[model samples]
Target: MRIFVIDSDPSFQGATVNVTVLPYEPYWDETVEGNTTRYSGVNYNLLATLCQALNFTFRRIPTREWDEVAHLVEIRKSFMTTVIYGVLPERLQRWDFTFIFEHAGLYFAMPTPVIRPSWLSFYYPLGGYVWLAILVSTLAVCIALIQVMVNEDMEKVKNAMCTEQMQ
Candidate 1:
């Protein structure tokens, strides 16, 4: 991908190219140990590879905020950023972008499956039929209970009729 089209010359002759760094996981990760700062990941690795190819050293201009990187690069304060910025029409008018290094997609991570005992796990494999049977049985039991309750009410009426017949 054309990271930057060097019209005059591709080689920097060991000159340092300034780059803006933002910590984006998997793309770029910034680690600071004492006074020295280190960067790793795909984007950082890409920048390092480019630097080696073009015979130029790179200096990272670290920034916490994202907007600052765009502003710095826009105003010519920095050469380019290693952070993966999406190419939009508005942004395209202001800056140049390399070919798409990453694609957009959704990824879902499933939780680790729990180990189950063979005896208990066998019950889990039962299909929807078991659930259907349980539901039907439950409904049948509820209907039976309502009928029994209604019969109890009829018993009171039967007792009153019996007392009237006795009188």
Candidate 2:
């Protein structure tokens, strides 16, 4: 990600605060395989911890104009650990956090796995049929009990009417 910061001096004596620009690079594994893989699979926590160790604050900028710059730029493969700047208090500044890329920009930043249609996880192997059969059987038994109760209630009502007519 490209970062730009400008510092201006309050006094207009033809003198400026001259700020040194520092670049920060965050690391993530490129070998992720599946779409279901969680974002935590990438070592983001470790990256944050490493940033804390260094005095510089880390911030993630959006990957804008990536399509135009991706071919021209070659991202460094080696891990970087360097310090550049004037000194500040250890506890004063905190690392700012943001998503590496926008949801649409993620496609350019990393190769995502193609999603596949989902099926029942339990419908695999021989043992799966046993559970299916058990569920069906339980449903059938409940249905049969309901029918029996209806029939018994109808028979009791018929018997009561017949006895009343004989009286």
Candidate 3:
């Protein structure tokens, strides 16, 4: 279990902000592999977005709380955890936002996470799919270009033969 500390921006003066944390299981999510892993949600973004939307400030604090999870064996005597600190204008507490957490590490800090729309869950596998499509498209274009060049050369040879025969 990771501990995320979320706070609203002080600039709001008296606005109350509602912050909710959602935990996700990384191992179970197939998107956790390769480039897709980057898009997965961590504790920090939830707070940051809320702060930004409310014109507040945010920070992330990581901590280890594996003991809090039920029936899980705490094999590691020590582990790292993270917390999100956000400051929002005091007026927006009425809006509700859900923050998601998956695995012990912060995915946002990593380079490979996919870019996703703010409202959608960061863990969606779109990045991997997009990358795969791009790779396939590039390969197909290369193959087509090679075929076009071969066809052009064959046409040149046919024209040369026809000219020689006419002469």
Each prediction's TM-score against the native? Answer: 0.55, 0.24, 0.26
| lDDT of candidate 3 over 39-108, digit per residue (tens) | 2344444445555666744222222343332112123221212233232454135222243343244345
**How accurate locally is residue 34 in candidate 1, as Cα lDDT from 0 to 100?**
100
* Candidate 2 pairs with clashing backbones: none
Q: Considering every candidate listed, which one attains the maximal lDDT?
A: 1
**Residue-level lDDT tens digits of model 1 in 1-167:** 66966567668799998888787889888788999878899988999999988889888887879889888988887998877677779988887887778766666999898898988686676778997898899999999999999999999999999999999
**Model 1 / residue 118 / CA error / Å:** 35
Model 1 pairs whose backbones collide: none
Candidate 2: misplaced stretches above 4 Å?
A: 1-126
Report lDDT (CA) for all predictions. Answer: 0.85, 0.42, 0.47
Best by TM-score: 1
Worst 10 residues of 3 by lDDT: 70-79
Candidate 2 global CA lDDT score: 0.42
